[model samples]
Target chain A: MSYRIEELLITTLAPMLEGLEHVAVGAASPIPGAAALLARHRGGGRPRVSMLASRRHASFTDGARELFDCAAQGRIDAFFLGGGQIDGSANINLVGIDGYPASRVRFPGSFGSAFMYFVVPRVILFSLEHSRRVMVPRVDFVSAPGTSPSNVYRPGGPYALVTSRCVFRFDRDRGRFALASVHPGQTLEDIREQTGFDFDVPARIEQTPAPGAQDLVLIRGPVGKDISETYPDFARRVLELDAATA
Target chain B: MTNLETLVEAIHDGASVALAPDYSGCAMAAVRALVRRGARDLRLIAVPQAGFQADMLIGAGCVGSVEAAAITLGEYGFAPRFTDAVKNGRITLRDSTCPAIHAGLQAAEKGVPFMPLRGILGSDLLTHRDDWKVIENPFSPDDAIVALPAIRPDVALFHAASADRHGNVWIGVRRELMLMAHAAHRTLVTVETVVDDDLLADEARAAGTIPALYVSAIAEVREGAWPIGLAGRYPADAAHLAEYARLARTAAGFERYLDEHVRGRASAA
Candidate 1:
């Protein structure tokens, strides 16, 4: 039941978006786009989803949360984003050169990192490229979350961290990152070996479930229309990868 | 020694402010500062803060209504409050996307009559708003035209990575702080430093960065952009921000938080 990175990202979002009344995505962010589109148009009576392009205002479905006004600042049930440089506390730095704008690296847009972190109830972080350099123990720059001086969101912060191989959540009480679950065909041993720092892993971690027929159908079917906005160019650039038929 | 109180007092009611496009360092801090001074009832001529500041203003009860920054339709996986206002028929607002609102405000701050813009058509966002005026397309008959009025606030607040006591600001990357200063009737600045007047009174720094002339009062607030980065000055306060993210779940919670953290407190630490 091992899924590729793309599959892991899209599929994880399908179920994770289950009970949300509404959600808001950030700008120049891809995973958020996929999540919003899937949640909005997934099931017949699914919940409302909103995708906020960092550049423009927000667009919603039915009565989903708005990004242009107070709704963007409203209580967002959940939030997901990739990390360029993440720390122990789950702070993100998408706009800086090694934590200082004066350094060698710079992300032109911060969009709403601080604002989103200011308002959202649940925060989920995703790092597409899981490497020691990218996924560091301490982030060089803190673009959004002021979770920790080093790493450790004050509390009830950075609910989860979704990497390609495994998923982790912050134990609010203990104030540390812990293993929440794993993707199908992945093990803590494998994920830990890949990770650079020492992390807390739950004893009874389960492999992430496989994408069911509904997930695939949703990913391939009506989901595209809802998402026609995010990848207007990319979606057209590449065709849907047909599941390999053995 | 200008704490949050003096900063807020500077912004009198019924004043004009030139709002920046994003949450710049000093402006962001000044906003919390201004809100503390009972400067509620803000009329946003443009959409700034990428919804972060917008949401803050709304939650703070500062924003009575808005005419800029269209609620990103079908964005962020949820409907926008701007849209909900239209849906539930609660809040009073007009639709204008973030950039348009910023651009219009900038054009106005510069004392320009009007400016040209794109991307609002075909969405019904700006279809029928009394604030926005639809005029004949001077360029062509085939395509009609819409004119965005200038948005000028009572007082403009700006932040810089490095600034002198006289208010010579250095905007690291974007050149928006200048626009906001020019747009507003009065401008306030909070910087990382209040350097010697000799360093601040330089004419060379006036090109991209705002000049001392445009700035009224300048305060040196270290790590002004705590939760957000201030370009070259310092990184965001990641730990503090994450705690805030957890607290920003509901308006009631945020309001309570503002009462305790922002309103209740005299200044932002």
Candidate 2:
């Protein structure tokens, strides 16, 4: 069965959420949001998925602070983060480029990444754009560090980084990212050329597996229907599911 | 009955105002009124994050500075006016993380000087915010955490579904509004309707109601959170927002948007 990149991304990310008690997807994250929904659907609703801005999915009654409070209390098992610039050490910069305050370029400032990256046990780093511009040797500003010092009271850190081209697993102890697998049709040289930072590659590199036929059915059917409430444009464009029809 | 203008007039220039994110309740009508009145040099305290409301305020040139975790039009893409203002040195940006902002307001709510939170030790947000301090955890030796100062805005402004004649505002599940009402010196609200029934008289509604004590004033403005709608009451006007996102990309376009939707409508009203 033919699959879109969105389908591939959802299938690839859904398994990472396996056995997680609760997975939260932040704002403007359509792909991860769909993946979480898929994971929940597959798990028979085992992992409670919380997608911010969606009333149906989110169970936070104590308002915006509840998510943070829940994370701080170590209730959230997995979360997703993205960056304007990400370094080899997994330091993600959601703040702007250049100096402090007066930035030459300003991406939207860090939302909950600073706190969530530390509190959530598994933080899957995601950025669709995988070029030197985004994957920098060093981030201009550290919105959230990939890893913290021993005494920082941090239980969570970077787990893996999923990009358009490949996936890289973060070694928290070493403070570096090692290539996990390349997406189908993307070569090792392509990833190496595009990446700004250096990473370790195992002797045998594997291709990222494609979504199964059943995975595509779930994604196009119920998962697409669920995500449309919050991210309509993404569902319509990618899954070809209209809000009315879905 | 209080008028929208009168409620907005209380907000003087240079006043620090607290605003909720788009997903929560937002007073877009009052924001347009502020722009209509040419309010200036305002300091915006976004509870944690902001979107269309903040962008519109910044684009209207009402804001002098913004302190928040983020200001972006989710799904619609980057908040154009905010991005332009930051890059062109039009406004001072005090960057913060989500929990820190919440913590700061929580400190204000508790009448405390500061509140300590975990994480953000290595983030550059620490370097910029002079008020934020990092100290050793007293109880746990050698452990470090960041302390954020209290965020007490002069006024907390938002739109809600309904208000009682007695000034109690029914916010439903958006309890951050209650927090803002508690933390701010004055809480100004614009509601869709002012019901004759006493909100506090009922047990179910009372749970979500912000009492008159915390609410300084309220005016009824139906569909007050237009373009960015109130949850359960209405879904966001995505087409309008997409149009806004498109037009707000350029300075001329933004001004045109202001003229057509904001400035022109204020005069018509």
Candidate 3:
């Protein structure tokens, strides 16, 4: 079935959430929020999805700190983090380029990644802008490391990275990412050329599967409606659903 | 009841102020008043993250430093003035993570010297923050954890849905205000309306109410969180925020915004 890139991304991300107890999405993330909702919709509502800043969808009553507090207690099974720059080793920099205090370019400071990346068992690094600038050789600053030392009391680390171009599953043990699959119409060479960091590639590369009819129906209908409440512009532009009319 | 200006006057120059996040209760009216009064050298502490309030304060040159996990305008995009300030070295940016900020405030709330938190052992934030320390868990050998010094602000400022004659403020589910009030030496509040009925009279309302003992002052400013909105009370004025995000991209445009909206101008409502 022909699908928009957003639908393709939602489908790609949904499976990762299967069997997870609770998945939490942070502010300004629509795709992962939609995907988590899709996963919940498909899983007969097994995994609870918490989309921050949404009055209708949020499960937390204790306020903003509750999210980090819950994650610390191992209540949140998965989370999504984006960065201004991400490297192959899975070090994500949400701070800025150059050095600290005197950074030439400043992206938003690390919201919860420094803590969330270590506590949440599965941290999915998602950034739609897949290019050399965003996927850097080395992040200017390490907002959160992809892996911690063996002795560190860390139960969570980088799980996989989903970009517009392809999927890279992070091996925490090896401290490296291996190419999982390229999205439709993308090549291995395209990913290699665009990506600043190096990664492992499988002998038989696979094309990321498109959203099936059922997936599209869920994405276009209920999931779109649910996400629209929090991210109206994204839903209207990407999902093409006018929240008022829908 | 004290007027809005009086409440703003309580926040003197160079005061260390704590503010709630964009999604939580934001005292935007007080923020504008602070800009109008040209309050200087203020240290802003964002409880995890911030938005327009921080940007406007920085843009107006009222801020000396900012300690925040992140500062962004949410769907509206990056907080322009905050970005400008950090890039130009106009303000000291003390980068922090969400839980660490919360932990600091929690420590102050509990009258403790510091609180221990997991993670942040390897991140560069530890390098920048001289205040945070790492210590071995005395109970468990060789297990290290980060300890954050208590954050005690001079004032915790925010707007709430309503307040009673007794000065108790009702914030509904936005409980971070409680933490801010507990951690700060003083709390200044603006409310949508001062209800004649006691908010603490009802058990349900009292559960969500910040008692008058914690509140130092209160003012009734209708739609005090204009453009930012209060949870369950009103939706954010997205068009206004979008326009702000657009105009604040440049320094001159930001001044124009302040002149039109903040200085000597009537409330947007």
Q: Rate the local accuracy (lDDT) of all candidates.
A: 0.55, 0.92, 0.92
Candidates ranked, most accurate by TM-score first: 3, 2, 1
What pairs collide in candidate 3? none
Q: After best superposition, candidate 2 residue A60: deviation in angstroms? A: 0.4
DockQ of each: 0.03, 0.85, 0.85
Worst ten in a row by lDDT for model 3 chain B: B260-269
Which wins on DockQ, candidate 2 or candidate 3? 3
List the per-model TM-score of the A chain.
0.78, 0.98, 0.98
**Per-residue lDDT of candidate 1, residues B29-74 (tens digit):** 6667766665666665443533344445555656655554322211
Clashes of 2: 0
lDDT per residue (tens digit) for residues A47-117 in model 3: 99998957677899887899999999999999999999999899999999987786888887998999999
lDDT of 3 at A150: 85
Model 1 achieves a DockQ score of 0.03
Selected candidate, larger DockQ, 1 vs 3: 3
lDDT of 1: 0.55
lDDT of 2 by residue, B148-202 (tens): 9999999999999999888999999899999999999999999988899999999
Calculate candidate 3's fnat. 0.84
